[model samples]
Target chain A: MRHTKIFVGVGLLLLLAATAWGSDTDGVTQETSFWIGGHLIDTSDYYKKVGEYRSFEEDVWPEFGLTYKSTTPNSRFFFKGHYFDRDEMFGMISTKVSDIFTGKFRYNSFQRQTGQDLLENIEAREWLPSVPKGGGKILTHDITDPDADYNYNRKEILSEFSALLSRENNLRLTVAHRAIIKEGTEQLISNSHCFSCHLESKSAKVEDRTHDFQAGLDTKAGNLDVGYKFGYRHYESTTPTPMAYYEDAKHPVKGTSGAEFGSRLNYDGSSMPIDAKPKIEKTSHKARIKGAAGKGQFASSFALSKATNKLTDLSAKSWAGVFNYAVPISPKTRLVAKASATSITADDPYIDVNTFREGKPSAVDFDYIRYSVLDRTTADFTAQIFHRLNPKTTLSFLAGYNRVAREDYPVAGDGTTSSTIIGQAKVRYRQGMKLTTSFKYRFEKTSDPFVSGKGLFEVPGDALEPVHYGYDAATGDSLWGYFYYMREDLWYQAITTEPTDYHEVNLSSTFRPSAKTTLNLKVKGVIDKNGDLDSLDVKHSKLNGNLSFTFMPDLKWVLSGGVSYRMEKSRGPVAVALFDG
Target chain B: MFPFPAVRGDSTIGEIEHFGSLYTMADYETKAQNVYLSISGSPTAKLRLSSTLMYNKSTGEYDQVNMPDPSIEVSSTLVDQDFTFDDMHEYSNLDYSMIQVSLGLSYKLADGVTFTADGEYADLTDDAGYVYGIESGSLFMVRSGMKFDF
Candidate 1:
């Protein structure tokens, strides 16, 4: 609501009459379109809730969208909105007055229903069975909807404005507010290795609100570019905590306790006297400058910024500065270098605030507080040479060196400083406009005796293995297809990181013999070993094939399908869970 | 403390996902506060000082506006649900205050030499308990130096 008044004042204050529109006569053009569609899906009960969002695998849903756009030489306005069956909606509008200033607004919202909660309430006679899916009543009407619906909804609004000053200077301002409310279940896990331990959960709607604002200005003076930005953000998050439930399931507040104290499944659905929520405030200030030296041949840029976030008694601060310079040596060679430093300070990090627990000694603590003091600096220098050998063939080489924390102490983590040195070289050859290839190699080593985690150039090939061949092989077929092969041998050893040898190979090929048919197949085998002995950590192979055809391409109608199968074997710790007796 | 409502034997792993689906659609927040004071200045060249102060307080309850009316009295059962951890909840809120001060002093020891001293102090206090239950804190630092030219 405050943002609306601010934008309105900005618009009125900056509403300058257009010089070109006052005398020139131009016709306006507009375009408007609307589409409404619905789908009938054969519901699948297994699609309960997937990927942190309600699944749309079943039921009938309606969707509609409308758009309107007006265009002219100096002014334009655009609007669009889309509504879906799951109580999801999106809308945006923007207008430009005489091309000097522009204003835009956006709003988006969606609701997610925890179906199981509603089902339980209905079966237990706590709610009327007259409820429907896709965002509607859960009980007879709205009687038990508040609890049974167990719905989470979020709505956010954003407004932005921009203006041009002195042709080269520009100013931009943005303000936004978002709200997220959930009345279902929330998970709270202690910061411990016991992930499988009895998970802590609460059934309640914890509300959260966030407000953000930013303003920036950029301009060029003489041969120098200058810019600055300032931002402020605030967040209030209320996490649901375990509490009692009311005896009258229908009445949240005016009901007696259903379960006695210390009894299992005892909940009163009562409001907490004090909720441990995180209230955070953050502010940032930044400035940048870029100028040309050496008669406009050497370009230099610099930026400095500082940001601090305060949440309750904890406070974190970040400061950074960057410098970059580039210049051309001869017509075919160019050199670039960059230097940057970042530092972070925390008054109270995430550590146990209280060392004593009232009754539960083994009970892990979800509350923590700590302090951090860290600083890191990095520098990069690169030299590139590109020469046209003859008329059609060209060659290029790039050499660069990157250093991290080259100087100063690593004040965080184990109270030890670690430094990195990286050197790399790349060569690229291009022949005419048909063939191009490149090869690059890099080497990095840590200076500290104790360091862990992924190293500079180590390939983390766990997620996926990709390989391809037969490109430009010139086969008689419309498209050439080849099997993929990859062999990687790299192992790291350290006291802080996982030391493992990773080797993987895979093959994938796609064949499009005709315009109407397509086929793709891929298979991969992997062998990952860790520790001093090359013991197999994981050995798995997978095969996948997909086939599709344009049954009736001419009429834009087609049907196709595919199937995939895979298996894996591993020697890691046995998959375990916290089981109850 | 036994995981709150549920007893020791409840298999809470799977229920987390099932229950999370009921309400975790989005994240929302609302806040309003005033900056009490933030100033930095020096009355004279010999003495320099700076201090900043801020306060934040929640407006009111957002979701439950129509629950308690003059028509019917609020039942006593509602009051029994006030069970909560000591350091938990922000129902009443806080009148927090954070202040930091820094001072610098310099005096000439000789015609071409001078000694300078600098000190800084900060304090933060809030009303909330648990993780943010920071009652108050103060930090002080002092440094002295001498300059000479010949």
Candidate 2:
């Protein structure tokens, strides 16, 4: 509620200031302008109704917006704000102080409402038991009595500042900070021994705060351009604690309860721990250098950085470096190269937490792990050449190579490395200045295939052995739900390795048939193969086109239409594992 | 895996296990198509009108990757015949779509003055998802304002 007021107050202040900043400048001899607007709005209801996933929730009762700018010989200021019916708001304020410094502050908040649809679905699940342990069948379902609301809200604020450090105002230092707060609910499910298993959801409150500070210096010293910068960023996040439970209570084994069957009804109400959500924080430091080389005809840059993260008693570190440069071979030709490498090392231990059942902690479950010792290093390189074939045509060629090596404490055996190489070519041509066409072709291949055999590596922890179930008299004609279990000491029972190849083609074109008519088209396709075997072969293709016509040449009146077609064909069926038989 | 303590002297040891292969290579296919048209015109420098028309349709057979099969993922309400596998066919005819329309207008108050009014109307339609026959919220909007400079 406090944050809500702050956001609304800031938004309203910005709007009023932008609309009310008139020409009465108290003899400051400055130029000023202001614009204000208001709107009448209504939604399908007091809340927004979304058609599908990833759709926007449009809502509001009324809205207003305004913008204002004040300028003088030494300084300038500007403000803008917009508030919608849903109470969603946005604000931006910027100012320039003489030739010394410049700064800007921004605030934005978006809202989504889903309680109506969510409740509808929850109430419709009559097949599931209405209340836990109430009976063998569902009779009634309700979560409101337990205090839960399905309203999501997101708000973010960012501020940045930069100061001029030289008389020429070419050297500057900058810093910025941003805070993002998000609240939402997520539905969770489990693939139990049965098809339909756990149906639950958790509502969490999460917030992330990040701060960036950078200082750089740039100057021109006789035919040479040099610049250096150092930046540091620290980020932290507080995530929601998971609260898993049945959306609507259900019979343990879907009716059929007797001594012949499982004797007792052992229901698991919730398993989420009090501190289920880890408090995560990461900080990184980076430095960069850029300069003009080869008599100012080539540009070059280098960078290096490191990062660290801590969660409880575990932590991780990473190091990275980059080098880039570009040079012109001729008036119409240029070559650019870039290279980078990164290495991350982490050492963590396992953890044991108690599992909750029937609204209380029943016993300890050593079936969890925090993290394992992991170290990986990767390097990549790319080279590109651009050439002008003619006054209206251009061509480019690019080649890239990448490799990775890793070791996992849990499965650190043989074949812990992978590598790939790629090559691509592109062409662009303009015909009669009315149509422009571009095409790109790329090929990729993996080398030195990595193979991991199926086996268990001896490690330190708790585990169960591979289990076998069979039916016997007095045991009923049935199979035990437990198929196999890993010994706490070993993981990765089976592994496989292989090489792969990938090829893709892309084409796009734009045409302006007349001053008021335009057309665009694009086609793309990709083929993926696994070595020489038919290991999950895949084919993908897409086609898109757009045509637009403006009745008036001034663009005051316009119309547009677009369509896209996409298809993915996989020869090997990945089979259904979630729901279907 | 169940880790409960058991007294081996039980009368009967009835077991519970899942049936049918988890995944299979089947003839699965999905198809979708969409078409839309839009037009806008300004009769005068101060008045404008625009509207949009859209239609979308999707169908699937033996395939429901996007059909909101919340069954296997959430509850068992969508299935009619328990685990008889007959319930799987409930999703065979996974087809749904809608025709949406939006109309908007804007008008200026006077010449040389930066003042305008804006409004829009949207027609809410029903859905075929689990929330069957439930119509989305309709929307109406209008706004007016002016600008000044000195």
Candidate 3:
């Protein structure tokens, strides 16, 4: 293919050179140019295997295509053709319209065919149906064989009409519609050598329409600015397989058909499949904004939007918002921030719910409503300040505080509440280079009534009558006596401070060698001290580095590579749990 | 949750366990490659043509295994003398390939008026016949259409 394109280029260069060198002395020169070009490609078997015991087959048949494009500056057009075992076609046309309102109309047609295979000739080993070995491998279970092949024919005529009212003000509207008629399915017998007696064939019919409207507005937004566009599309497909003689060849076994395999055979057939209607649509809109920002500054911009969905299930909604802000932050600093956010939401009702009980009466009880032991709500606040110390240096500071509380419902008594305070600092240098250091001291205390483990009492039920009767030697003391010796007021005095205190320290650096790339090297150190536990000395540290690179030579292609390394070390107890009853 | 081999009791603490002799496991890994090309041309000064071709191939391996346990505990295995299993083992493989080609034409009558015509054909094949347990099938399709633009 590369060799062919090179040859074509050389031919075109020779033609242009001859035309320039062979010019007569006449003041007027008249010449006509003609050009033709095309390409063809083919590939074969490719495969990949896994797990030492299994194998796979991958193959692509030889297929070829070609195109011819011609142009004469003011006028342009082209002709195209393609060839494959399953399809073949040829067509062409051209036109030019720029001086005034212009339009075009054309007609095209083609035929499409499809075929299926013999299920019996296919193997069914581990599970499913199986064919007899060698000579008698015919399928008998299915009274009507699946489609072996079908053909579809399409014929369409299109026209586009548009007019430019004036040079400064122009409006153009385009509409295109297509019609297709597909033949119905038929039965066909295999070759004499094959055992299969017949196969089913079917066809499909399709109709579609597309529209594009564009309007140019030349107005002054202070100066002259132009903007315009619009689009629409629609499609429909139908398979009118009437309800006259529809019989399900298979029946449900354990569960519903297609849901379970154990009950797949239907001795008394009573099911069938139905055809569905097409539901696809789309719409689009666009606009442009361009003008001057301020003195000595210029600005130009564009905006576009498009959406698609099904009529039956119109649950998806998506949108994009973009803004470009360019202003001076200070006499020596210019700040430019471009931010865009896009979100999409879709709800699918087909999602299965495990709570459903088939064939059971639907009733609501207390068990149907789920409740939480405690309800809680928390609000947080955070802030960061960025300061420029010099042209190549900057400093930043961050502080945050949050308070959370868990209150038991149905009452408004003493509840558990926690509060914390955090602070950090950072410094950064020129492009892709920076040094960051931070220190955090958090004061967290929980306010709740405390009870000592030594002061507790237990009452025995009828099931534990033996223990109450003093038959269990493990608890020699009577319940009344044990309760008398318990201490229940260890925390009754005035409390000086809440309970937990913690501190953390961290330092790191980030570097970028070039645009579309980033690298980072950092070390984090932590020390956690708690007042609630006797041995509360815990420390954790980690050294980590990461590299990322993205290569987009042009908009058409992209390549990306990345890697990361981390080393973690710790010298402290991770967690400890205590339970008392 | 059918016959899940469970034991029920009302006591505060209770436990139940079961063991089986046959073990079944399966795994598969696959990779694929695809390529697409298209071209367009014009036969008449107001007519145009376009063509496209695409090919894709995917290959993978599958493995299945079943074996009796070499370790045992107090729980009894569910294998009986009359219940005989052959421990069937078969190598499974699959190959899928598809190719599509289309030719289209467009005619321009004026600055805002035009006509278009297109024909498309596609074929797909899965080589699953070599294995004892697999399905081998192939598909072929062709379609053509025309549209009026205004």
Candidate 4:
């Protein structure tokens, strides 16, 4: 309630300013803690994933905590607070003055619970029989509001500042700000098809907000060390925009053609407006540099960004460049390298589904103009090497390459490109602190990967040949070539689960056999394939494992334990489409 | 491909020609398991104790590999029919299991006061129920507190 009275009035004004600054400061230190709690929850079946992120509701709460420290001699202060209810809370503050300036502030609040997809398994049944009169009808749903309950409430705030401009070639200045808020109520589903395979669900209202700001500057200009940053972000969603009424096209049991069902609908006797939430803005710029080359150290960066979409005014722009290097090559070898490049451009919109069957004699004119699969470009490179060979061993090796290019997609005017190559190896061992171990292996290869331009069993077989599109003179009926070419020749091209070859493996171990026992273990594996999917050999696999332990047998007992396992499997190809339209 | 005449007079063949569908292979799976335990202690100098335990289990499924003969005569007057999805894979199966437990205690009366208590329990077992049905649940929580320091 009102954020629990502003967190109990800021925890009683920070406990009366830390008790009057610890009675006239002098290496001050303070602590304030107060708690009076009550919590009780008993659930039988509220199953929202077991109170999705808690608040199982059973109240009566009061908790407050504070800590402060200051050790004069050059000034420095820190503070912390925790007020546990009102959807959890936290606060922090920091300060330093004397060695030039520093500041910090933070706040957080949380709550999340969402689950209400009672779609009832989306039923469907159409017993063939040359479908066309509602053929065996089934599939129906309508839940205008079935005791909906979704939740959301998140808040965050952060602030930071830094200063110290100039002190013999070591200048600095930094600033930051952040804010986020979300309020909720959700659940919206709308469906309509061929006329009556209905389904409808409602209730939607959510407010969202986000803000971010950044500023930076750093110095040192002789051996390098340079920096620059500027960023801004904004997002909005003031709720209110949820409407649905559609459902009026015709023939669902002979309601009559209605312009042949409004010529493959793109809007129908409607109320429109459903699920709308857009308004975003972003801007960024970055530049960085770091020094010392020959013996090691090197860094570089460049970035630019722009994103906008205030209700579809549409915009997107991106740029990136990066490089890094580390060196040493004697007395135990070492080397590292990295490179990156990125580009993106977007802005292409024009759709007018308003002319399809406008005054039909079988009218046709489906306006179009859209192509932007987020126009992309990317490049990456990597190199790594490390060696120790003795003193508790160490070894490493890596190689990488990547490329992607897209301007349209799949085959929109023929635009596509992809490439990938990677290899890796690692090993580590230690016996000093009882034990330590590591092992890794990786490999990847790809070329022409990303697919999905009308996926799923690229249909053909002459799209099931059977031509003859001529009758229907007020019910002579026969008009068939499989409904005008079986959806443009039954999708015959792109499809992918994205992986042309892949392999990975990892192993880890850690053990501390003495001073208060400890142990850990890990394992991972993956396998992927897509051999150009013709008869669909697309495959996927994964496995994971973990084990943990810890024990402290003295100082009054302490123990721990853990175990984990995971498995995943996939195999593609599932095409079943033969619509009787 | 001949066999026409329709408009409700029925001589069959209005659509669906030969094999225009059915091409199975589908198989999707998921599995998960987890276990955890923790314990903390302090035997003297004002009491303290803690405990925790957790368990989880998961499953997901979908299957199909071969299925096609349901009637097929594609010729003399065509007859094709072939469709079966096992109730859409048992309405998209998923099995679940979960368990959690927690406990804590503290004591140190005077000098800056302290005395606290905590408890929690959770359980779930939704064995294959999709689309928010039969969610099986259990939960219990308790808390008591008294702490002061200045």
True contacts kept of each: 0.00, 0.36, 0.00, 0.60
Top candidate by DockQ:
2
Candidate 3: count of backbone clashes, pairs at least 3 residues apart or interchain: 60
Task: Please give me the DockQ of candidate 4 compared with the native complex.
Answer: 0.22
> Better model by lDDT, 1 or 3?
1
> A1-581, model 3: which lDDT tens digit per residue?
23323433443343334333433345432322221222232223211111011111123333333444434434333334443323233333223334333334333445543333333443322111122232222333232444333344444434343444555543333333322323334333322101222222233333332222233333344463545445444444444422212223221112233211112222112323324444545454545444546532333344344444464554344444444445555654444444443434333333322221122222112122212223443444444456687776776565655555544321333445555565666666664243233322222333232212231222111111111212225865532111111112211222111334434444444554555344444444443333443343322333344444444444333344444444343332211111000
Candidate number with greatest lDDT: 4
Whole-model alpha-carbon lDDT for candidate 4: 0.75
- A86-156 per-residue lDDT for model 4 (tens digits): 77678877766666766676778778878777887787665555564545445687888899888887878
Kindly report the docking quality category of candidate 1: incorrect
TM-score of each: 0.48, 0.69, 0.36, 0.32
Residue A152, model 4, lDDT: 82
Candidate 1 Cα errors over 4 Å, as ranges? A1-25, A37-42, A49-62, A97-99, A110-151, A154-156, A168-185, A188-200, A238-277, A295-311, A348-369, A373-414, A423-444, A447-581, B1-150
lDDT by residue (A321-357, candidate 2, tens digit) is: 8878788889999988888888876755565443322
lDDT of 1 at B79: 27
Compute DockQ for each candidate against the true complex. 0.01, 0.26, 0.04, 0.22
CA lDDT, candidate 4, residue B99: 90
| TM-score, prediction 4 | 0.32
The residue-by-residue lDDT of candidate 1 on A1-581, one tens digit each, is 35435644454343223322322347767777665544433322222222124323244556667788766777877878877555468888777766466767776777664432222122111111232221111222112233333456666666667666666454334333333333334322211011111212234465666667777777777777777777777776555443422322221212222222222222223432233566777778778788887632344434444334344466656676666667666665555655566655556456443322224322223463343434344555555555555454445555555444522232344344444444445455544443344444444444442343322222222112222211234753332111111111222322222223333444444555555555555444444334432221322222222222222243333333343343333332211111111
